[model samples]
Target: MKNDITTRRDIEQLVNTFYDKVQRDAIIGPIFIHVAKVNWDHHLPIMYSFWAGILLEERTYVGNPMMIHEALNKKSPLLQYHFDSWVRLFYETVDELFAGRNAEYAKEQGSQIAQLMHHKMRESEQ
Candidate 1:
């Protein structure tokens, strides 16, 4: 089995690999590319820090996800399928790369984040 996420490099790898799939995914790709217009060059490092902080407790990431996703929801309302696909891709990416506490933590955290985003977005719509 592969090693768990132990360093910033592992986090970067996970984020990069996961987003590569996201950028091409049929269900979610357009939301990210056409709608969000994510600049990978800038987004990737922020994500690295985000995951590194989450998985490694590195305390590196400090951004407002709720604000960002809330804005995205306004632009193109995110439905359940979007969160579902995102979580699916996230778990699949984690499974493909590593197998350990941190890996499981990443999946669990991803689920929680997705759920939170979905709930918050729905609330914003009201």
Candidate 2:
């Protein structure tokens, strides 16, 4: 049985594996790689901090992801399917790596975050 995500190492593994899938995914890969021009070397650590804070209460992440996404949205025009793909990849990654309360919490939080982001994306259009 897979262990629950219970440490910083677990979060790193989760984030890394998830982004690996994201980088390869045709649906969302271009949005991140081409449109956003994400620098993985720098971005990965920020994601680690972001997820670590959400899952482990590490209090490490400090940035405005919404603003970042808002700017990215202007570049490529984020749509519902983009957010959908993101949430799907995240849930798949979590289920593949871990199983337990924390893992479940991670999925819930991820789905909510995606939903909220999508909502904001729509709001910006109006």
Candidate 3:
């Protein structure tokens, strides 16, 4: 049986597993690997802290994700479908690894984050 995400380790696992998929996702992979040139070593730990703060209330993350994404969008115009694929992949990741309130909450927050970021990116473009 799968478990509800309840610890930092769980957050790390979720983030790692999700990014494994993201790195291979044809829709967004190049955006990360080629466009953004993400440093996984650097990015993954930040994500662990980010999600842990959100899901565990650890308050360890401190960065402006919107600004970062805005810069990335400037480099490669982010479209609606890219956001859709992101949300889909995030939900798939959470569901695959966990089941419970926290898991559900992660999806809820991820969806909202994606939608808001996508909206802000579009607004900036116009």
* Separate clash counts for every candidate: 0, 0, 0
As a whole number from 0 to 100, the lDDT of residue 65 in candidate 2 is 91
Candidate 2 residue pairs in clash (backbone atoms < 3 Å): none
Model 1, 52-125: lDDT tens digits are 88888888789999999888888988999999999999999999999998899899999998998898887767
Model 3 lowest lDDT segment of ten: 117-126
Query: Can you write out model 2's per-residue Cα lDDT over 3-103, one digit (the tens) per residue?
Result: 99999999999999999999999999998899888999999999999999999999989999999999998988888888889999999999999999999
The positional error of residue 93 in candidate 3, measured at the CA in angstroms, is 0.8
Rank order by TM-score, top first? 2, 3, 1
Compute the lDDT of residue 10 as modeled in candidate 2: 99
lDDT of each: 0.91, 0.94, 0.94
lDDT per residue (tens digit) for residues 3-55 in model 3: 99999999999999999999999999999999988999999999999999999
Residue range with the least summed lDDT across 10 consecutive positions in model 1? 117-126
